[model samples]
Structure formats: C-alpha cells, structure tokens
Target: MKIQGKTALVTGASRGIGRAIALELAQQGIRRLLLVARNRQRLAEVAAEIERQGVLVVTLVLDLTQIVGVNIAIARAWRSYGPIDLLVNCAGVAHQAPFLESKLQNLQEEIATNLMGMYTMTRLIGRRMAARREGTIVNVSSLMGKVAAPTMASYSATKFGIVGFTQALRGELAPQNIRVMALLPSLTDTDMARGLQLFRWVLPMTPQQVAKVLVAKLEKNSSEILVGWQSHLAIWCQRFFPSLLEKVLRIVAPLSLSRSKSFGEIANRQQATGNRKGFWRIVLDFGFFRSNIQTFDKGFDQGLKDKFPD
Candidate 1:
C-alpha cells in the first residue's frame, strides 16, 4: 500500500478529486503515474504538472464508457508502466431527474460510466496485481451509496452498487495481497455538481481536501473511510434508526425540492447571462451554504453523543 515510488493509475484525472488524487500520489513519490480521462488537453495539463515534480506521467484520453476502448487503454498502461501498484477508479457522472421522467440513455450512461467502467478497469489491473501479489484499489464512492435521496435515485443506485462491489471485492482479493478500499465522500465541489442546484445546500469540501483524506487512508490500508461528519451520521442513522430517518427525510422533502428548483433557476439565469464569473460566484455561494448544513448536522450529532455519553 506504500505510495512512494509506486506506479499509480487514476481515472477521471482531468480534474476534481481525480486530479487531486493524481497529484497527491505524485507528491508521495509515485514516479510512474498514468492519468486517464476523455479530454486530452486536460490530461496533458495534469501530466505536465506532475512531471514538474519530476515524476514520469502518462496521459491517456480514453472514454471509459467504451468497453473495447477501456480494455485497450488498460493494455497500453500496462505496457507503459508494467503492473500498476495502485488503481484509483474516480471517473463518474450523476443525473438528476425524477424517476418517471428519467431517460433510458441517461440511466444507461450512469451505469456504464460509474459502475461498469470501474468493474472493467478493476478486473484488468486487479488480475495483474493478484499475479504480482501486491497492489491497492480505491473506489471513490459517495455517501448516497449508503443512503437514498429524492431525484438522485439513479445516481444513488450506481453508488450503492460501487459500495457493494468494493466490499465483495475486498473479501475476495484479501488473500491475494491486493487491498480494496472504498473512499466514501459526501458532496464535493467539482464540475460534476455544476448543473445541480440542490447540492448547494449540501456544502461539500473541495476535491483537494477530500483527496488528502483519501491518500492518508490509503496509506493506512483502511477498508472504508467516510469523509464528513454528516456522511458518517447519515450512514449510522440509516442503519440504527431507519423509521425515524424516513420520517425526518419525508418532512424535509418539500424543502429539498424547493431548493432544487431555486438552484436550477439560478443556474439557468447565469447561463443566459453568459457570465462565467457570475456562474462560478453562484456555485461558490451554494457550496458554502451546503458546507454550513453539513457542519450543523455534524454538530447535532456531537450534541447527541454528549447527551448520551456512550
């Protein structure tokens, strides 16, 4: 699990958490780094940055949704870097539409990108790792993977699948000396959240912050690490008090919908204005507000713990 001088492959490495993770690994002395994403330019940019740190970086612009392309990309990476010591499956997408209104294509894409892509990449590199009897796999999952939410049914399903996949794979691969870890992050500030307004109230940490925790946990070979306090509480609540949690969610559903509507409107207005600055300003505001909610939720949990003193 040691990162220093290791060869690491990070999918979705063009930006956000993937980019941060790639950089983190490089900083940890992971010399042979493979950065994968659909955008060649961005991938090259990341590669340049990593190379500045004196690490050897390979950029692959391959759409992971394509099964054949993914297999080819894995083969190319292996040829270039030999057996990958660490594989970080970070590529993902989210669709926010009501269940009844959701399109089949959108659902298919989510499953293909979020679930199947990870499966494909893991299987390819995992086999190599097992043969070598050394490696680590980190799947960047979400808190929604552990609990469901309105309008995010499809997204949540994919995340839930990831959770299950990682857990089962961990059990299967332990004997092979290949550690499978799931890094569950709450909402995070990234382009993926750009079109979603309701997420503004969820206030997520920056990708860099989440990446720091991810890398730290990987070093310790932790099986799963929940990112935020609210995330931990959400998992515990769903597990220990499902009835109470359901009632609370039902009461808050209307407010959540209203927030989503408002956010969508704001995003549309910003788009109409064609003001990039204004668009990002709104995003920043939303991120901050969401972070506040996460803080409050965590504080509430702390208060409960103080009262119970278990």
Candidate 2:
C-alpha cells in the first residue's frame, strides 16, 4: 500500500481526482505512473506534469468501454513500463435527470463508463495482479452510492453497482494477496459536479483533498476509504439514523426539476411513454425510497460507494 517505489495505473487521469491522484503519486515518489483517459491532449499534459516531478509517466488514450482496445493498450503498457503495483479504477461518467424524463441513452452511457468500464479494467489488471500475487486496487466510488439521490437515479444505480463489484472482488481476490478496496468521496468540486445543482447541507471537497485522503487510507490498508469529516458524518447518519438521513435527502433532493408540470400532466406523460406497469414497481425501479439498508460500523460498510468525474 506504500506509494513510494510503486508502479500505479490510474484511469480517468485526464482531469479531476484521477489527475490529482497521478500527481500526488508522483509527489509521493511513485516509480512509474500509467495515466489512462480518452483525451490525448489532457493526458499528455498530466504526464508532462508528472515527468517534471521525476516520475516515469505513461499515458494511454483509449476508451474504457472498448474492451479490446483497453486490453491491448494495457498489455503494451505493462510490457513497456513494468507491472502495475497499484490499480485505481477512477474512470466514470454521470447523467443527471428525473427517472421519468431520463433518456435510455444516458443510462446506457453511464453503465458503459461507470460500471462495465470499471469491470473491464479491473478484470484485465486484476488477472495480472493475481498472477504476481501482490498489488492494491482502489475503486473510487461516491457517497451517492451509499444513498440514492433524486434526479440521479441512473447515476446512483451505477455507483451502487460499483460498490457491489468492489466487495465481490475483495473477497474473491484476497487469497491471491491482492488488496481490493473502495474510496467514497462525497460531493467533490469537479467539472461534472459543477453542472448539477448543489445538494443542501453538502460541503463539496476539492479533487486534491480527496486524492490526499486516498493516499493516507492506502497506507493504513483500509479496505474502504471515506474522505473528510463530511463523508464520515454522512455515513454515520446513514447507519444509525436511517429515517433522519432519508428525510434530509428528500428535503435536499432537486425535485424542482420539472416545476412547470402539474401532477396530471406528469401522469399523462408517463402513460405516453408506455409505462403501464404497476405504480409501485416503477417507483422501486425509479429509485424512490431506495436506500441502502446496512450497518456501516466504522467504515466497514459494504452496501455502497463512484469513480472520478473529471
């Protein structure tokens, strides 16, 4: 878990937390850094910064969803830069909209980038780590993964999926001496988060702050990491005071999205979209009252966790 002399591969490294983590790893004396993202220019800029810090940096411009391309690039990188000692699955995307009005394309994109994207990278790198019998994997999931948010149903679902994936891997890969973990950072001030209306009572942390916490937690060998006092407090409420937290979420949720529409109009709109199923079932799938019911005793919760939205 030590950063010094480690070879780390960070996805979504073009901007946001991934970018910050790459820089932080360099500052921490990481021997080799592999930065992955779709933006060639941005990835190159990040690699340049790390190179200035005297870290051997490599950048890969490939989409995570493209499995074959990712496999090829990662294989080449491992051959050229040596094995990756740390794998950070920080690549993700978010689409915010009311479930009823949400586009199918948006949800598909979210799944492709957030969930399956993590799956693809983790699977490929995980095999290598297991064979080597030593490595650390940090999956950057979000606070939204712990609590469902209004108008963010699709995004929340993907984040929740990430938590589940990380947990399963944690147990399955433990025998190989590979440490799989999750880092839950609450509302971070980033390009993707800036577009959404801020939730009440939420103090957004900067990407650098989250990155710093990641490194600190890595040293402790924490299977799961939460950033800042805000994340700790939020998860505390979620575990001991479920009802209170749910009520707070309802009050802060951005339900004012379609304020111009009446109830009858909304019902009619749903009917038009061929939503003739039972109301409660649709509500369940839509994430209404969809809370993660679990005991998060001292950051050991497995119920939920998002990737870097850079």
lDDT of each: 0.81, 0.80
List clashing residue pairs in candidate 1.
201-290, 202-290, 203-290, 203-291
lDDT of 1 by residue, 68-128 (tens): 9889878877986787898999999988776787799999999999999999999999998
Off by over 4 Å in 1: 199-201, 250-310
All models, RMSD in angstroms: 5.8, 12.2
Off by over 4 Å in 2: 258-310
Specify the poorest-scoring 10-residue window by lDDT in model 2.
301-310
Question: Candidate 2 lDDT (Cα, whole model)?
Answer: 0.80
Model 2, 208: alpha-carbon shift in Å?
0.5
In order of appearance, the predictions have TM-scores of 0.82, 0.82
lDDT of each residue in 194-243, candidate 2, tens digit only: 66754544556779999988987888868778888877887887886666
Let me know the TM-score candidate 2 reaches against the reference structure: 0.82
- Model 2 clash pairs? 140-306, 141-306, 142-305, 142-306
Report the error of model 2 at residue 141, Å: 0.4
